[model samples]
Target: MASNKFKIILWSVGILMLIFLGFFLYQLTQSESVNSIMILLMLLLGLILGGVIAFLASKKLVSEPAVITESSHTIAESMRKVFKVVSAEGHFNEIYNYEETTKLFNFIPSKKKALVIVQAKVLVGYDFEKFKWEVDEQNRKVKLLNFPAPEILSTETDYKYYNIEEQFFNLFSKDDLAKVQQNGKQQVIEAAKKSHLPEVAAEQMRTLLTELLAGKNFLLENPAKISETKNLIDYRNMNNSR
Candidate 1:
């Protein structure tokens, strides 16, 4: 609406300026004196002032929000109701893998259409870690993965271990890092109990969750254990293995 008003104001200003120019031209042709120049200057000043006023008026109109009706409210409610109807029911589980030292939660909805992995970590001293959500759709199924950070492997070490401490330390201060670890641990327990995930998956999830939430540093800093869980396998590999 504001955009339309601006256009109208622009058009009005243009028309008024054109009208003033035409009058000024007539004066110049009819009279040849200093008074004619002054008249033309006055016309220019009036056009400038008018343009400014019109621009301000248009801005004022555009900045205001539009009013909504009861009908719009009803439409929004109807859409929400439809969404609830179509949404499927799924199961959730928390898994901890000893090898990976990570915790993860798996959610399986009634639709059997998507696999979602939610990873939550703590950032520095902040109460919450950045959450990342990734969704992969395959064979009419959607796989969603959400984690604080992307999985990192140590190239120097033969055994690939997820260095939770190193990762968190890199992002946060020492004090903040400690808090993040504590939160990560709590989150793992919550995800496990809440999701009621499978035992195998829950174990791996717990490992990672504990490392992230433990409030302490990892045990083996150099020769870190590698991640070899089936869940860690690429999506395509998961399908092929199945």
Candidate 2:
């Protein structure tokens, strides 16, 4: 590549010299010749000097570093044969009343309670690691057997406390905060189990695979056994609790 670029630059210099010579001769012929020989020598010297400057400028322009807008740094990476695809997501917002009691003596009891507000999101999808399939490219046949089951992929929960009440003997402890948060998160998970998020994600996955295989005209041999993921996670029915 460097050799080719050098040859191109040499050809450019030769062409420039020819153009300057032709122009100088044309102008000399049109005007009266007082010192034509001296003018010719001077023109030759100027052409060489100008061509050298142009060549150096072109080289400088080509050698300048490329401009970068984003210098992104990679922190972590991993290789995976199959990745879990989240096809559907749902949000569940509910208020949970966390109540607890502690026994100070045989008959006396200390009470503590808080109105816990639960806000959470549930993501449902299929893990491709469990997927089973068979493909025949020769006969244009695709058999999709035991498909990956759509399950609760992940969940995010946030809690807020309101109207917290407790006696001096049964004030909030370190375990109380963790216990309330766990209880609120569990409620959201249980609610997601009854929703239709899993079913919707399964349907979306089916459509995606069908469209992908349509281009190659691969007939789905086993379409009956594909939709097996039970419906779970419904956003509409995620109602607030007291």
Candidate 3:
């Protein structure tokens, strides 16, 4: 939509310039005294040339920053995938894959390149609470400060707690864990230990473990599912307390 509007504005400006040029040409032809009219025509031609040069220069100036911004975004996204691999658990390594693509535009005659970046994220595991926590924390901090929040240790800890409790009450399900028995118990233990969950949040996960072991199913199935549940519980509790 914005691109369409910009195109319309550009076309309108060009049309107005052409109309002005036509009027100047008509005035030059109709005048009986050719000297003043010739001079006026030369001035009008200079103005048109000046306007075109200014338009091209402005387009180059505007396009450079947008190209740089898109390049930076692409680089940042690449860094994220590289870091995720370096830090991810074996469970994640086994389950998922990452890919990215960029759309390039050459808006001008120069070798200047503008990009539109798109990242594709696919999750294969049933347990995506950890990923959700990281995303939510980033979003929350960004919202609070109106800036990209740095992933410092303290902020990461907070996110871990939030996501773990969030996942425990939400994503763990009997069917999901049915295949993860004593054979895979070691893997599960290692994953839980290496996870970024806080102590309190880890303790809460014990109840989920118990339910899974006993072959009971939770009504909720994901972090988003748990968040909805939390909202409903909060609403009901608030009403009841009153």
Residues 1-242 of candidate 2: C-alpha lDDT, one tens digit per residue:
76458758778878978986998898888877679868988988987787787677667656556898977788756765758788889999978998888789767888899999899888877777777899998888888777756767677777888999999988998888988888888788777777777777878888777877887788777765557655533333233222
- For model 3, the superposed segments whose C-alpha errors exceed 4 Å read 1-3, 54-155, 158-242
Q: Whose TM-score is greatest here?
A: 2
- Report the C-alpha lDDT of model 3 over 115-214, residue by residue, as the tens digit: 2111211111112223232223322321111111111111110001111111222343454333222213333333333444322232333334335534
User: RMSDs, each prediction?
Assistant: 23.6, 22.3, 23.8
Indicate whether candidate 2 or candidate 3 has the larger TM-score.
Answer: 2
> Which candidate, 1 or 3, has the higher TM-score?
3
- TM-score of predicted model 3? 0.25
Query: Deviation in angstroms for 11 in model 1?
Result: 1.0
- Residue 22, candidate 1: how far off, in angstroms? 2.7
* Model 2 residue 178 CA deviation in Å: 0.9
